[model samples]
Target: MLTYTPPIAEQRFVLQNIVKVDELSGHNVFADVTSDLVDAILEGAGQFAAGEFAPLNRVGDEVGSKWSPEGVTTPPGFKEAYGAYVEGGWGTLTGPTEYGGQGLPLSLSSVVMEDLGSANMAFSLIMMLSPAAVEALKHHGTEEQRRTWMPKLVTGEWNGTMNLTEPQAGSDVGALKTRAVPQGDGTYRIKGQKIFITFGEHDLTDNIVHLVLARTPDAPEGTRGISLFLVPKFRLNDDGTPGEFNDVRCVSIEHKMGIHASPTCVMSYGDRDDCVGWLVGEEQGGMRAMFTMMNNARLNVGLQGVSIAERATQAATRYARERVQSAKAGSASRESVRIIEHADVRRMLLRMKALTQAARALAYYAAGLTDRGQLGDADAQARVDLLTPLVKAYGTDVGVEVTSLGVQVHGGMGYIEETGAAQHYRDARISPIYEGTNGIQAADLVGRKLGLEGGAVLASLLSDMRAGAAGEAPLMALIEDCEAVAGHLATSSTDDRMAAAYPFLTLLSVAVCGWLMALQLRAAEREDGDSRFLAMKKAAARFYLDQVVPETRGLRAAAMAPAESLFGLDEEAFSA
Candidate 1:
C-alpha cells in the first residue's frame, strides 16, 4: 500500500510565519477563525485524510469507478468515506455562513485542501468542484438560486460539476455548440453532448448540480453567444426535495490514464427533450460566470500538483533510507549502506524537498492573498489575479517534474505497478492539461493579466517582490531580470509576446517562489523552533535559491527570443 504523511507542520509554519494569517484578526468576517480554531481544523482534516482517504487511494486506482444504466458506482469505501466527510463538516469550511458552512478564511481552506490532495488526489476531486461552484453561485447566481442550492452543495450531501467542454470544443470553449432553448416558462430545454465531465455521474451523493455552458437561439456567434445554465440530475420539488427524473444521462465514461477513480462522463442531455435547465447570470454571460469558478478551480488544480509532489517526496525519502545499496565512495568498509548516504541520492532527495516546499509556499501565498481579497483588499485581489496563472502552470509543471523524480529514486521497483510510484506520475500528467492548459495560462498571463489597470498590477507585484527580498541577492537579481523582460514586452510585437507567454509564466513563477522562500528563510532565522526543523527550512531555501532560482535566467532568454525563432521552420521543412 502507498503511504503518505500529511505535512501539517510545514503548513502551520507557512500559515503563522509567511502568511501571517493572524493579522486578519481585525476583519469581522474572519473573527471566528482564530489561530487555535484553524489549527484544530487542520489537525482534524489531517487525521481524516490519513485514516480514511489514504487507504482508498490504491483501491480506487485498481478498481476505478464502474458505470451502468443506474448511474456510477464508485470503488469500495468511497460512498462511506464521502458520508463521513460531510458528517465531519469538511466540505463547509469556507462556505457562506447563511448556508451550512462554517465561514472560515480561504487560507485555512487551502491548508486543509493540501492534506486532502496528498491523501488521495482522485478522491478529493469528487468534492473539489463544489467549492468552486459555491464561489460561482455566491458571485453570480440569483438570490433564490443561492437559497435553493447552496445549502446542499455546501454541506457535501450533493456534489457540483462544471460542464464546459464538448466533443469539438476542448479548450476552445467559444466553439461549443450545445443549445439551451427557452421554453417560455422561465426554464430552458438543454440539448448537447458534453465530454470530460469529472464526477458527472457518481454514487457518492444523492444529487448532482451541473453548471452547463450552451448557446441560446438568436444569440451571437462564438463566445458572445454562450450562456450558463443550471441543470440538475434530478429536478427539485416544491418542498426542495428531488422530484422529477431529469433527461440528463451519462452516455459513457472515458478510460483515462490517471485519476481513473474520477468518473469523467460523456453526458447527453435532452435525449427525449426533457432536460429542464435554468439560466444563470444573464444571456451571453456564460464565459464571465464560468470564469468565476474556473479561476478558483485553477488554483485548486495547482494545489493538486503540490500535494502529489509532497506525497512523492515522502515516499522517495522513506525508500531511500530503507533501501540499502553499495557503500558510499571511499568508505572504510565494503558493507552495504542506506541509499540516502550516497551523495547523488541525497541530492535527489533535497531537490524533491526543495521543489515541493517552494511550490507549496507559492500556493499558500496565493491562497492567503485570496483570503485577503475576500476581506475587501483591492490590492490583494489584484495580486491574486497576477498569481493565479503562475500558481496553476508552474505548480502543476513542477508536480509532473517532482513525481518523475520519485520514479527515478525507486530504480526498478518504481516501474512495477504494485509499488505505486508510477501512479503518482500518471496522475500528475493530467494536471498540466486540465483547468485551462498551462499554455493558455501562460498566454493569459502575458496578454491579459500583465495589462490590468494599465500594467499597474504587474508593476505593483514586482515592487512587492522587491520589498520581500530586499537583502536576498539571488531573489533580488531574478526580480530585476523579470522587471526588465516585462518592460520589454510593452514594445514587443503580439507574436513576440505570445511566443514568450509560457516561458514568462514559468519565469515569474520561479522568481516569485524564490521570493517566498527568501521570506521564509528570514522568518525561520529569527523565530524559535526545533533547531533541526529551522535549519532544514533554511537549507531548503538555500537549495532553491542556488539551484531552482537560476532557471529564471534561461526563462528570460527564451521569453525574449525573437518571434521568428518558432516560425522559421515552416510548413515544408518540418516533416522532411
Candidate 2:
C-alpha cells in the first residue's frame, strides 16, 4: 500500500514565503480572504484528501470504472466520495457567489486542488472540470443560461465537460467538423462526434453539461469557423430539472494505460436528429469564449503534473527508507542496509525531490499571478500572461520527468502493478499532451508571449529578473543567461526568426525555473536553524542550477540554428 502524506509544511512555505498569501489579502478584491482563512481551508482540504480520497486511489485502479450499454459506472466508493466532496462544498470554492459558490480566490482553490490531485488525480479530475465549465458560462453565457444551470453546476449536483476533439481533429481546432445549424427558435441542432472527452459520461451527477465547440453553416473556414455551444445530456425543463434525454450518447470509452477510474469517452452528439444546444457568446466567437476555460484548464493541468510528481516522490522516498538491500561498504556482518543508504538510490531520490519542489514553486507562482491579475495592480495582468505558458508547459514537462524518475527509483517493484508508482507515471503522461500540447505551448510562448506589447513583456520580465537578483552570484548568472537568449531573439532577422524562437522558448523556460529556484533558496537562507525543509529547498535549488540550468545552452543553440535542418530532412531516408 502507498503511504501518502500531503507536504503541508512545504505547501505553507510556498504560500507564505514564496507567493505571500498575506500580501494578496491586502488587495480590495481579496479583502475577505485572509491568511488565517487560507490556512484553515488548506488544513480542511488536506484532511479530507487523506481521509476520503487517498484510500480509494488503489481501489480505483484495481476495480476501475466499468462500461456497459446501460451507462458508465465509477469504481466503488467514488459515488460516496463525490457526495462527501459536494457536501463539503469543495466543488464550489471557485464558482461565482451568485451561483451558490463560496467565491474563493483562484489561488486558494489552486492549493486545495493540488491536495486533491495529490490524493487521487483520477477522482479529482471529475471535480476539476466542473468549475472550468462554470467559469466559461459565467464569462460568456446569457442571463437565462446562468440562471438555469449555474446553481446546479456550482453546487456540484451536475458536472461539466468540454467537447472539442474529433476522430481526425485532435489539438487542431481548425480541422474540427462538428456542425451546428441555427433553428430560428433560439436553439441550434448539433451534429458531431467527440473523442477523448474526460468525464463525458459519469453516473456521479444527475446530469452532464457539455460545452461543445462546432461550426455554423455560414461560418468561416478553419479555426475561424469554430463556435462553442452548451449541450446538456438531458434537456432541462422550466423548473430546472432534467427532462427528456438529449441526443448525446457514449459510443465507447478508451482503455488507457492509467487513470482507469476517469472515463475517457467517445461521444456522439446528434446521432438522432434532435440533439439541441444553445449558443455560448456569439457565432465565430466560440474559440474566444473557450479560451477563458482553456487558459484556466491549462494551469490546473500543470498543477496536476506537480501533484502527481509530489505523490510519486513521497512514495519512492518512503519505500527507500524501509526497503533493505545489500550491506553498506566495510560492514562487519552481512546485515542488509536500507536502500536509501546506497549512493545511487540517494541521488535518484534527491533528483525526484528537487524536481518536484521546483515544479511546485513554478505552479504556485503561476497561480499567484492569476490572483494578482484578478485583484492586484493594473500592470500585473501582463506578468500573468507571460508566465501562463511557462507554468502550463514547463511544469507538466518536469512532472513527467520527475514521476518517471520515481518509478526508476523503485527498480522492478515500480514496474509491478501493485506498487502504484506506475500509475503516477501513467497519469502524468497525458498532462503534457492535453490542454494544448507542450509543443503548442512552446510555440505560443515564442509567437505570442514574447511578442506581447511589441516585446515589452519579455523585456519587462528580464528587467524584473535583474532587480530580483540584486547582483547575487547564482541569481546574476541566471539573469545573464536570460538576457543572452533574449538578445539573440531581438537581433534575429526574418529568415532565422522561427528557428531562433524554438530554442529561445526552451531556454526561457529553464531560466524562469532557475530564477524561481534561486528565490526559494534565498527564502530558505533567511529561515533560522537547520530545518530539513530549508535544507531540502537549498539542495534542490543547487541540483537544479547545476544539472538542469545547463540544458539552456543546448536549447539556445537549437533556437539559433537554421530551420532547414529540421525541415530539410529527407522523408525517404529513414526507409533504409
Clashing pairs in 1: none
lDDT of model 2, residue 258: 80
For candidate 2, the lDDT comes to 0.83
RMSD of 2: 2.0
Q: Number of backbone collisions per candidate, in order?
A: 0, 0
- Mark the regions of model 2 whose C-alpha exceeds 4 Å error after superposition: 329-335, 470-475, 490-503
The segments of candidate 1 whose C-alpha lies over 4 angstroms from its true place after superposition are none
Alpha-carbon lDDT, every model: 0.89, 0.83
Q: Which candidate is the best by lDDT?
A: 1
